[model samples]
Structures are given as structure tokens and as C-alpha cells.
Target chain A: MSDNVVPMKRTGEATPSLSPILSLTATAMNSVNQVILDRMQSEIPLIPALAGHLISGGGKRMRPMLTLAGAQVVGYQGTRHHKLAAAVEFIHTATLLHDDVVDGSETRRGKSAANIVFGNPATVLVGDFLFSRAFELMVEDGSLKVLKILSSASAVIAQGEVDQLTAQRRIETSEERYLDIVGAKTAALFAAASRIAAVVAEREDAAERALDDYGRNLGIAFQLVDDAIDYDTGTADMGKDRGDDFREGKMTLPVILAYARGDEEERRFWQDAIAGFRIDDADFAHAVALIRRHDCISATRERARHFAQRACDALSIFPDGAARRAMVEAAQFAVSRGY
Target chain B: MSDNVVPMKRTGEATPSLSPILSLTATAMNSVNQVILDRMQSEIPLIPALAGHLISGGGKRMRPMLTLAGAQVVGYQGTRHHKLAAAVEFIHTATLLHDDVVDGSETRRGKSAANIVFGNPATVLVGDFLFSRAFELMVEDGSLKVLKILSSASAVIAQGEVDQLTAQRRIETSEERYLDIVGAKTAALFAAASRIAAVVAEREDAAERALDDYGRNLGIAFQLVDDAIDYDTGTADMGKDRGDDFREGKMTLPVILAYARGDEEERRFWQDAIAGFRIDDADFAHAVALIRRHDCISATRERARHFAQRACDALSIFPDGAARRAMVEAAQFAVSRGY
Candidate 1:
């Protein structure tokens, strides 16, 4: 995890937190935070209540950070990215709300999921509210190109969610399908968030695409590490419960890879657990043991490292600076988890 | 119910069907239908399966018809309105899917609600998909103004829905609050749908405002009649079950009006019925009798008539023609349900 060990160019001391990027974009992030609060405000008390619960909830604001940093990296001096950052956060939060309902999870970020507290109907409707608010922000920005990028991402995200729903509990889900889900459900927004910064900078297609590639690869790596963590995360300070993904029978990359490479009897065991026929503590222990024995978590992290490397490489197009270095460290930070 | 009986200027025979305007915008309506079918298409089988269930389900396409008629009335010749009209329908359908989930509706238009057929999660996500697709349509139309109108309507609709949720089974809900809920939940979209026609036609501010007013009033009138019909809809050809609002404890106009004017004993009956404390077949019959005795249904229709008159008056700014006449009759037709 040392800066020397990381393959990315060493521009400064490796900050373990996102604070470097956050401090660099502190003023703009503050504006983005204000915009998030202002937009979720409504005469309907339920909206602000529920949206505030999630917005002020323990979200790292990573998506918006990527946006602000994306804008800053390209030296864009404008206020529009603030609104766009808030929009990105709203989209991400909306997906989380919907995902909680779909996942039927009781907790999020170590607290009660919004759906559990507010009820499924309110969570779903408030998610809709956040989504509409996102579009309103884009429309207020008055950029058709921005609107097109974000709206398409929104659609792709929904499609990815549906695809994941279909793939749930199906042991035959291929690596390609799993990647497609991650790309659309997670990375699509990341790509859009970063690409939008370039759009605001009015940068050329190459820069826009580069930032998009950076965000997309980072998103993939982040999700891979998350999936790996669900099995055995040493970084338990984040408060995410282990084995929730296994209980939910989510086809994360580690499970998919393990199930694909396992012996016939191991495959049967996975199928039974995934099909919810006989899931128990022993089953979880067995699954974790299998994943560890096969080095599935490490393999997943290895894949994540590859993508993280790609994410750092994508930033080579941008000039070296504090912003670019923080972004590169952010990529390294994603894959360095659970080491 | 004839043209002569209506207060609006008579220019043509009153047709109970929406065919007059539908035929006038036949080509545009066709394109809208294509877009609707096209946008709902996805690689995920459940999306199209569930969306097709609701899309091809027995919806009358009334909202999209309004958009088409509104465009034709404004003498718009472009195809953007077609896309806009499709967007309007998508919004309407998206709300229906969510509404079915929220209301726990078993049936829509004499068919099982999408939530019942496809489960709530898929229905909710597909609804999100349709909403995002609607925004994509507006973005493709490249009109920030259009996006503004539609996104605002979407926000209002969600807020209105939340307002209605708060008011559910609460007899203390005032007529003003009920109207507010209706305005946000239904009329706002109508306003946006009609106003967008003027926007696309590049009409003056006066025309845009006029069309917006017309659609808003018509939407209110339409909802009022529908609420009244929930008590006793003589026009039962549409196959909607009577007393659904009553069974669900929905505080529709008739229920609110009757509850406001009822005697002390009757008030208790209504409070208990609406609170689901004593809802049964006998309660429905008594509720119907009470509504009839208090003239609440007629009073509701009378209120609808006033809004219908306003809707017609809003059209006076435009020139008279078959389209205009059809639009005028459409308003009267909204209030002439029981005849």
C-alpha cells in the first residue's frame, strides 16, 4: 500500500483518505453539498425527511468527488460542475435507495436502510424524486450533451439492475454477464460523472474519453474489491456486514469466478446455497473456506488491481498535478483494500 | 351530454370517443406509438415482459392523446411533438407502475397490475427505466424548456403522490389538500403535456400559458369525474371496478365531500369505513347511499363542470377548427361521465 509499491507516478505522499481531492475541491464540494440539500427540499415533508436521511447518511460522496476532481484535473474554472456533482450524487443515492428495496437489506453503511425506516413505497417514490431532481439539475445546466450522457447512464443503470436481478441465484451466470452488470449498474454512472467534467471544461473528446475510462475502470475495481470484501474484508472499519452478498445470492465477481472454477461437488454446494435450499452458518463457513482455499478473493483483487492500473493509466493524458495525483492514488486506493 | 347541452361554443357533433382528435393526429399518434414500443424494448426479458404487460394492457392512451391533440390544435407540423407525446405516455405509464406498487393494486384496466404479475422489484425498476427513457426523449428533442416542464411535472407528481400517501385514510384531509394532491399527481402532467405543444410550436408566452391552463383544468375535471365515478360510475364500459377508492380508503372527492357534510352518526360511519375499521360490502352500500343522499356525487360533478368550463375558456385564445372543437368537446366530455 506504500506509494513506492504502487505503480502509479508518485507525485506526493500517498493520502490514505479521499481528503486530498476533497480539500482541493473543498469549496466546490461545499457548493455541491448545498445544491444537494436545496434540491431535495420540498413542501412535502416526507421527501426532505427521507432524502436527508440518505444524503446525510454515511455516503462517502465518492461519485461527486470524482466529478469535482474530474473538473479540477482539467483546470475547469466554472460553477456548473458543482451542480453536476450534486446531480451525480443524487443519481447514485437514488440507485442505492432502489437497490435496498430490491435487495431487501436491513442495513446500509451500518445503519437501517432507508427502505426499512421509511417503508418501501416511500423509499421507491423518494428515489424517483431524487432521480427527477437529477434531471432537473441537468436541464438547469441547459446542456443537451450533458443531459444525453446522464440520461443514457440512468437508463443503462436501470438495465443493469434488471440484468442483475435476472442473474441472481443463477450459478450459470457468466463472467461476461457479471462484467456487463458491473459496467452498466456501477461504472456507467462513474463514466458519466467523469466524462461530464470534461464536457463542462469543453475539453476535446480525447480528454473526455480518458476521464471516462478512468472512472469506468475505477468503478469496476471498486466493485470488485467490494465483492471480495463481502467474503472476508479485513478493512471492517467501514461497518459493512460480511456475507450479506452471499445471503442475497448476488452474483458478484468472486462468487462467479469461484463457481466457474470449482469442482463438480463444490459447484453443487454453491448451487444449493445460492438457491437458498440450505444456507446456514456452516454453509457460509464452507463457502468462505472454499473461496479462500481457491484464492478467489485474491484473484478478484488481482483483477481489480488490473483495472485500477488501467484507471491510473487513463489519467496519463491529463497533466501531472495534485488533482491528477490524488485521482491516481484514488485508483490505487480502490484496489489496495483488504491487503 | 350533447354539444348543445354543453356551455362551450358548438362547432361539431359531440363524439363520446377520442377518435376525432385521434384521427386528426393519426400520423403523429402512430409515430408516438412506435416510439413507446421502441423505447420499452430491452435485452432483459423481464423489462419488456413486464413493460409489455402494462403498455399493451388496456390503457386508453388519454394523456398522449392530449399531447397529440394539443399539438394539432396549435398547428404544429413537426415530428418533435410525436416524440414528446410518447414521452408523456411513458411518464404516465411509469407513474401507473409505481402507483400500482404503492396502492397495492391488484388490477389495472381489468388486468392484473404489473407488480402482481412481475413482482414489485422488477416493476419498480422498469418504471424507473421508462422514466429515464422519457427524459432521454426530451434530451433528444434538444429543448431545455421541454426538459424543464417535464422534469418539474415529474417532481410534482412524486410529491403529490407522497402528499396523497400522507392523507390516505385520514378523514381530516380538507378539500383544498385533496385538490392540491390532485393538482400535483394528475393535473401537473396534463399542464406539462399541453404546454409542451406550444413550446414545440414556438408559440408566444400567452399561448403557452393558455394551453397549460387548459390542460391543468381539464386534468382536474377529469380526475374529479373519475373520483365521483368511483362511487357510482354509470359509464362502466371501461371495466374499472366501482368503490375501489372506498375499499382502499382513498379520500376521493365524493368521500371528502360526503364526510364534510354528514351527520354525527354518518361521520362516524365514514371515519370507520375510511379508517378500514369496518369496511365491508354493507359499508360500501351505505357509503354509496350516504353519498347519494348528500348529493356529494353531483356536487363533485358540479365542481368538475366549473373546471371543464375553464378548460374550454382557455382554448378561446386559439382559432376555431375541427381540432379546436374536438379539444373543446374533450373538456365537456370529461365532466359528462354519468350521462
Candidate 2:
């Protein structure tokens, strides 16, 4: 995973280099992350106790950075931006805890998952705690619009999770349905975070929509990349066991698309592997090879790039500032990062 | 268990002449229950498919009735009362679904539990959907105060559940801690329902306090009775298996208090049954005998009655109206009903 951290630029882009933007983003994110950690430690003491092991176990804090960067790009100067950033992190943490429980994941980021450490009941209830605490923090912002956006997003995300659970291992699941699930479960929060920042900054409607669009597109790109990496990357690169999604019968985008295009033998393998849950190592390897042979990985990666480009397009409406430049760079970084 | 139904007076006073009040309360509850079924059916089109299964699966709907009675007693004439009542029911239903999943409960209300039918993931996520839908209904009321109350209660209830999970099976759990958990997890919503009714009715401060106290005390009594029934009732009587609390390692008030007063043998029985998870039918019977011999069942019953009396006390501050009389009767019913 560490070996995949490339510099934040494409090799052939003729756009002027923006090193200062990256530096500003890093500085802003550092302060925002600190605020988030401190608030999480104080407000949800149990979270720090439970998540401390995992926090140190390592995560990129990418969501917090997105929020902070989004706020900064729109010229947000108030300290409330810090609170919003922390709220974003809390929401993300809550979802991760619940997701691991739902997935029955034993390891996350190469460390024992929360459910593995504290048990599923503790992991689930604590996840509820973080979600509630996130709402309390959002309420403190005193923006009804922000509250509405966040509350609605949370509802959508939860529904999306249920939709995925219902669709798991179902041979009838389509790529469009898979994308819809991803959009609600993963992208809604990202979009809410970015849009809330713009709302807090009191940006014009167009700017708010642009930032929201940027976040929505970036979130889709990020999730697609994640799904694609599950097939292309090894366990060492992904920091967890590879092919667990297929083993668990989850119909991710690549799997759904590949199954749609497979030959009779390949299709039978896919059905037995996912639908029948006959996911031996050889079958996992076969599914991976089948996805690659079907050009699903490259196709999915291209789809991610398309969304990344759309994310960049949303920023065109923004003034040329350090934050705007960083936003553009971050979208590209999202696509370029290895699984 | 049916034979043991304590035939205490329907009113806390030494009078059996409160039959009118009981009948009025019953009629009001019947109407409210119908409204609840209608609204739940209207909103969930899948109700026809699932309602018979869920409704026949038997729940007391105590929380929803509390909401309706609370609103009626506060003189709220608006149609929003029904929505609030349904909101309470939805929240309660959500909790029950999640509770069954967390406890791995196979039976509820003398039938197969939802998780036993739909699987754990579905139960958990559907529970989440109910909660989200509850919030959506609350938002439609357009009362930020109600939203705030319900939201805070939701958070506190979830936190209480987490606290219970962390403290489960710990022999060191105290009665005070147990009370805290029951108050937050069970009574908080009850209090919120009544308090929100007052807020909606724009009542006087004294009236609001009276209703809030009534609801809180009623909730405490309700939970106390529930805990006691775990020892005194069987599956056929209680609609679910007895000794479930013990099996789940939950440290209810009676158990905590009993453990404090237990002899060495009894203490060992509890330790093995709960903390060590070595419970058997023999252990359950032994535990029941110990509880009876120690008079813990009677002691717990007295405490429940005390809370019921306190609930009636809150109503003395209200006017001599039918609603107030019904509220008083309901409290008595909660404590003295089929044991």
C-alpha cells in the first residue's frame, strides 16, 4: 500500500504544476484532522478507546481532507469548518464500523476489525453512538439546510446498505443497480460533506451545486476504484484478504459486469462462486482471471477516470485558488492511487 | 404464569371501583391502536405482505399508546398526534428488530422472530430503515423541538444499548447502573413521546412537567415488570421464552440485586450461568428458585408498583379530565396487569 503513494500529478497534463495547493491542503487537513481527533476523543470517549487501535492501525483520513479542502476552496474562514470536518470523519467512522459488522470482516486495513476486537454487538452499538454523535455535532452548526442534507443523506446511505444486502449473491443484479447502491451508501455522505461546506461558506447556488457534483462524482470514482482493485490488487496491496467480496457473495460492479458477459463455462463458475457460494481459492482465482479477461478491470478504471474528469469539471466554476487547484489534483490522485 | 397474574387494584388507591377509568383507557387505546395500524399500513405498501406476519408476531405497542395517551391528556387536538404516535411505534419496532438480532433471539411473541426468518443482515438494515422512516415522519411535523427531542432520545437509547453490551455478564454491575441503563434505553423514548406532546400542544410548563414525569415513571415501571416476568413467566405466558435475559447475560435490576444478596452457591450459579455462559435448564430452574426464595420477585414487584404510584402522582397536578383519569389507570395497568 505504501509503495503505491505516487506524487499528486499525471505525467502528461499540460496544466501548470500546483505544489502550493497540495501544501495548503495538507496544512488545512492537518489542523482539521487534529480538531476531528480531539472532538472525537472528548465527545465519544468510547470511540477513541475503540477506534484508537484502528486509527493507529492506519487510514488515509481522505474524507476529512475532502471536507476541509472543500471548505477552504470556497473561502470558508470560520472555525465551524473544523466542526463540519470532524462531523464528516465521525460519519465515515460510524459507517466503517457497521460495514465491517455487516460484511463479517475479520480484518480491516491489515488489523483486527472492531467487531473482531469488541464483538459484533459492541461494534454495532458503538457505530450507532458515532452516528448519533455526528448528528449532534451537525445540529450544533445551526444550519437547517446542513441538517436536512445530512439527515437525508444518512437515511439514503442506510437504505443503500439494505439494498446491497438484498442484492448480495443475486444473479439478477445489474451494473446500474450496483452503481445506485454505491452512490447512496458511499457517495451520499461525500456529497453531503462537500455541499455542507459550501453551504457554510454561503456560496451561491451554482457553486454549491458544483462542489456537490464534485463530491458525488469523486465518491463514485473512489468506490469503483475500490471494487476494481479488489480484482486487480493482491492482499498485500489492498491491506486485507483479496476476493473476500466475491467469497461473501457481494455483487460488486466488476463482478456484475463480468458475469453479464461470461461464456457458458465461465458463467457457471461465476454462478457457483457467487450464487452458490462455492468460493474456493481456485474459484476466486478463476473469477479474478475472468474479470480481467473480460476487460472489466480496465473498463471499470476508465469509468472511474470519467467520473474523476467530471469531478474536475465541477471545479471549473470556482475561482483559481489554492483550494481549487488542490481539489483538481485530489480528484486525479483518487483515480491514480493503487488499490 | 397466567395463574400468577397478580390481581392488584386497577387504581393504586384501595378501591376496585376504577373500572370506568379502565374501560375508558382501553377504548382510547383501541382507537389509537387502530390509527397506528392504518398509518403503518398506508406508509408501508409491503405491509400486506409482512403485516400479518409481524402483527401476529405480537408486540405490546406500549410506546405508541403512550404517545397517543400523552397527546390526548395534553389536549392536543391536531391530527399530528397520530403521526407522532406512529413515529413512536416505528422507533420501538426498529429497536425490537435490532434487539432480536443483537440477542440472536429465535422466538418473539410466541412465533419465529424476524431475524430467524429474514436473516441478521436484513433484520438489522430493516431496523435502520424503520428508524429513518420514523425520523422522516417527525420531520414532516415541522417541529424542530420534537425533532431534537426524538433525535436526542435516539442517541441516548443507542448509547444505553452500547453501555449494556459493554457491561453484560459482569458480576460487578450495580443496581444503580442497571437503573441508568433502563432509564436511558427504555424510559427515554417514553419521556420524549409525552414531552413532545406537551410541546405540540403548547401547554403550560407545569402540565408539561406532569406529563413528562408520568411517562418517565410509567416507563420505569413497565421495564421493571418486564424484567421480573423473565423469572416469573414462561414462553406461553410472555410470548417469548423465559430466562432470555439470563441467556443474553443482561444484568437486570433483579439479578444484580439478587446477586448482591446471594449465598456462595447461588453466586456461583449466577456466575456460571451468566459470565461463563454455562446456563442450562437446571441452572435456570435453580436461579428461579433462588429468586423466589430470596423474595427478589416480590421486592422487584414492589419497586414496579412504586413507580406506578409515582406516575399516578404526576396526574394529580392535571385537571379532573377523562384523559387524566385514563392516564392514571394506564399506569396502574402497567404495574398490575397479567403478571
Interface RMSD of each: 0.7, 3.0
Q: What is the lDDT of residue A335 in candidate 1?
A: 83
Residue B312 in model 1: shift from native, Å?
0.5
CA displacement after TM-score superposition, residue A161 of candidate 1 (Å): 0.4
lDDT of 2 by residue, B1-339 (tens): 232232235444753233544454465556656755654442223332233355546676667666767777777777676677677777777777778778889987888888788777766666665666576666666677777777778788887787777678888888888888888889988888777878888888887787778888888988988898898853237575788987788888778778888999889878887785667777788888888888887788788889888887877765566767667767777776545
Give every candidate's TM-score on chain A: 0.95, 0.90
Which residue ranges in model 2 land beyond 4 Å of their true spot?
A1-48, A55-57, A234-236, B1-56, B234-236
Which has the greatest DockQ? 1
Give per-residue lDDT, candidate 1, residue A245: 83
List, for all models, the DockQ compared with the true complex: 0.81, 0.36
Question: lDDT, candidate 1, residue B327?
Answer: 79
CA lDDT, candidate 1, residue A75: 94
| Model 1 interface RMSD, one decimal | 0.7
* Docking quality band of candidate 2, CAPRI definitions: acceptable
Compared with the true structure, the alpha-carbon lDDT of candidate 2 equals: 0.74
